[model samples]
Target: MKTTTYNIDRINHLIQQYQLGKEEFLTLLSEGLKHPLTWEAVFKEEIQINHLKRIDKIFKKGLSYYLDPTAPVTSKESSIFFRKEKFGTNLNLASKKIVSQFEDLKISLSGLAKLSDINLERKLPVFHSHDNPVSVANTVRELLMPRFKKDPKKFLNALIDTFAEYNILVFEYVEHPSLKEKTNIDGFFLQPNVIVLRRNQDYFKREIFTLAHELGHYLLNQEEIESMDYDQMAFGKISKVEAWCNHFAFAFLAGNELLNLDKLPNLTARNDYNFNEIKTISDHTHLSFSAILTYLVKKDKVSGAIYAKMRRNQEEEIQNRKEEEKKKRELEKEMGKASTASLAKPIQSPLFVSTIQSAFFDGVINEFELCKTLNLKPNQLEKYLR
Candidate 1:
């Protein structure tokens, strides 16, 4: 039966309350209606197609940074590495490790906190007092500036990547959240040190900026922030703390200098194509493909309508490709692990969420660090809780 308008609005209201993003909002919307999208759906849903593609591109670029910590920054395209999916552990199985580590981490933290008076100087900062992206960028740069003597670029990158190392450690490939989300986020600060992606998947350039933006929040020890839904933000009445986090994220990622529109005209003249000029400029600036495109439109390098059309077209194409692949993989079922493998019988796997939960319940781990390690929101993992 089709849902009534009232039900649909109710559903939307729930999503808004939970802070879901457009991608996540659409996903939850479909799932809540009892029509979970499949690969076929991707082809049908142009927006999702574009989103997944953008995410995959960022994953690839981010992977490059992971593969060679010391590799030259320009080696982004070349230095990236990947294992054949055929050889990688199924994601369902991989998630168990996070559960296990959560317990291990809890114990470590508890030991330190009880034995010593460890005072956390938890003060979060944003651009001194402005909304400039560059201001926040400079703030983060300044925060990490003292560490410049220690591999400057990597530290700069780390300012944006909170959990890059954890991602490298727990899973061989990027992890799609093991659990379903009821909300959208600007992005989730999944692991304490890592920000699971939110946007910047398509143009391939905005990946760094978005990641850096999320890093701004995590750097200051925030848990969850609203997504790019400005409508909600306008009437939503977020706390001052949340606003500060947003300011930090914007500033840290795009840098005030990069976002200044006045300077963009000059930039366009300097290069045959300015911010919107694809190909070399994105790579040269270490910006994502989308960031440059959007900036171009903002600078009047492209019309808003044209930009919107391009975005839609790009999103549609990517969704189509993903849907096609999803179909191929579904057909390859016998040769591949089933998505249901995530619910693999408790005794079947080598990894153990059982052990992790037990340890936490037994007081072997501290709550904060345990939750951090599990990549879980405080009370989200029902099975892992006592």
Candidate 2:
């Protein structure tokens, strides 16, 4: 049986929030529904359940949100949206949605923590831009050393675990194909303590660097949204905070080899720019060989021309790899086999997991709420809740 939903007010509010006019909203729905929709029908409560579900998908809010009597919150006074004047880069719709989702999760975590009497206070000390990044990096590295791992995947997972230990909530969201738009930004830090990263399957090393860079911002108590491009680090004019963060990330990742980086001789054709040594350091640090070379250029250890040539070579290599992968996928298709592509899963923060578990055990949140908060299935809840 068909049902009517008279949620015009909520629908209109979302339309306004998305900066869409009534006609535009209806047009968008029509495209998705494969039929023309009119605002007149919406006003008269003639919209069906299927229509409401379609609208809910667009808003990313559940259907129950529209059924509730209360309207969605529009105030941004307490949000990072209002607090941070500059994001360092403009966010696309997908990036903005991911950020908003994590912000909402942080709020929920805080509320649940309070109900369970959990002390979620951040422990890392804050520093100013004038502070020596090397000194700060050394201190933070010492703190995280206990969680250190050499392998790339283990290294990233270790970092996330370390961040959780310090009361910093780390969350990763994937740029899934089903999303209306993919997020261009790599990661961002939300003040008071939440860091969000976009999952990168092809290049996990970049994700590791981004995590350390955002950690720099956290230690400096500065909030920022950034893409973390190596090319920009080598050539672009950046603010003091950004430069500090870059240096901190480098020093933290390099560990004891930071001094070696400073003491290294200038690269010249005579020694082939010490490529072998650089590669060794890169492997140890899990930073890309190109990124390490770029850092050398930034420090004046390598000339701009050499950096540019090496960068071109690296780009060419990457392109060749992509072509190879494409051919392999095509071959797989011809063989009636599935293409082998890495499917990434978001890394869960241990602190975030335990907080929801505590909430569940204390009766602050029910079983359904527990699964929802943890983003787990009913069968998966036992591993966490137990």
Candidate 3:
């Protein structure tokens, strides 16, 4: 039996690099090796080939990683903010996996850009912490054009397109079989230009708002993960940054017209403002119902108590709607009919796709590599090629 000698220093370094304590490392080792206790001896002296293989698998690293002192470390630091609750240990792992995927995609896109001789520069507008949210929002809206804001779906696509034009990478994560229910984050922004959105949102309006909110983080260059509910945007509870961003998103989506309360129909002076009236405003502005209500509260048009009650009612309504949709899907399955819900679409930026295609045509990458990088099947390659 052949035995390989590993530098004990490197082994210890890897353990620290992964932030794995001795006890946790032992537990991970115990899953593979029957006599985990003996691994301590191997760690101090020399390891058998079989033991080395198991260790590599446990650490999720290549065998050569332990041998080479100059090998680059792969750990990345990320700060994620959950709007609902802090992630549990399992959920944290899931969130990290998502971040890792983003990192990998960014690296691939960056390499493709370099090979294609494309210049990727940051072109997003910058705003100070104390900058007026309404002014910033108007600026962004003008830049994005008010025409795209007419339809929520069109608005979202156009927003992504605009961000891509500015060299920002925006992606929507479709809940595929492999990634179902692993993470519940609504959206997240990664520094230097990467934003991700979950594809299973109940409302396109919510997605639009989230995109705007994440854009806020992008402008401020703050990395965050958020569930981003209406309560988080409430006047008193939210941080200054969130408040500014929420206002910015409102202005961006609702436009300067909504800034004038007189434009809205007279409120009935009822505790909760009429839902129908709010719905009308939402439809006309292409803004979410919650956004309208939040603005009302901010303007002191709606009482805090009323706003809170409305929020709860809205949440209940959303829950009921989701339940109804779930049952509807189940019924469709029974009837052998396709689901009403749309399938998750690929979320690659247009620029990213074009760069990859160009690289493929230039023979910098082959068809297989292109398909793999784009997360596409063989059939999908033709669409890009043409």
Best by lDDT: 2
Best candidate, TM-score-wise?
2
What TM-scores do the predictions have?
Answer: 0.41, 0.85, 0.77
TM-score for candidate 1, residues paired by index: 0.41
- Candidate 3 lDDT, 1-386, residue by residue in tens: 57876665666755654455688767766664556655555565567776677677555457876776564443444223222233212234345556556765776777777887877768866677698877887777767653546667777777788778788778888766564336656788777788888765468898878888888888887667777667656665767777777878888777745745445543445523677767876887777878788788777677777777777888899999989988988988999997666566755678778788888887889988988878899987788888
RMSD of each: 18.1, 3.5, 5.2
List ranges where model 2 is wrong by over 4 Å.
1-57, 63-78, 177-180, 338-342
For model 1, the superposed segments whose C-alpha errors exceed 4 Å read 1-116, 123-128, 131-133, 142-181, 188-211, 214-224, 229-251, 254-276, 284-286, 334-386
Question: What tens-digit string does per-residue lDDT give for candidate 1 at 108-187?
Answer: 54344444433222244422333554455575565442222133234334433333222211111133446442223334
Number of backbone collisions per candidate: 32, 0, 0
TM-score of 3: 0.77
Expressed as tens digits, the lDDT of each residue in 1-386 for candidate 2 is 36675556777666655555677667767774556987665456466787787787667878887777776565553356656646777766566667767777888888899999998998988988899888888888888755556778888888888878889888888766676678879999987889998887767888888998999999998899889778889989999999999998888888888777778889988889888888778887887777788789888999888888888887898889989988988988999997666556789999988998888889999999888766789888778855
Output the worst ten-in-a-row residue range by lDDT, candidate 1.
78-87
The deviation in Å at residue 39 for candidate 3 is 9.3
* lDDT, candidate 1, at 320: 96
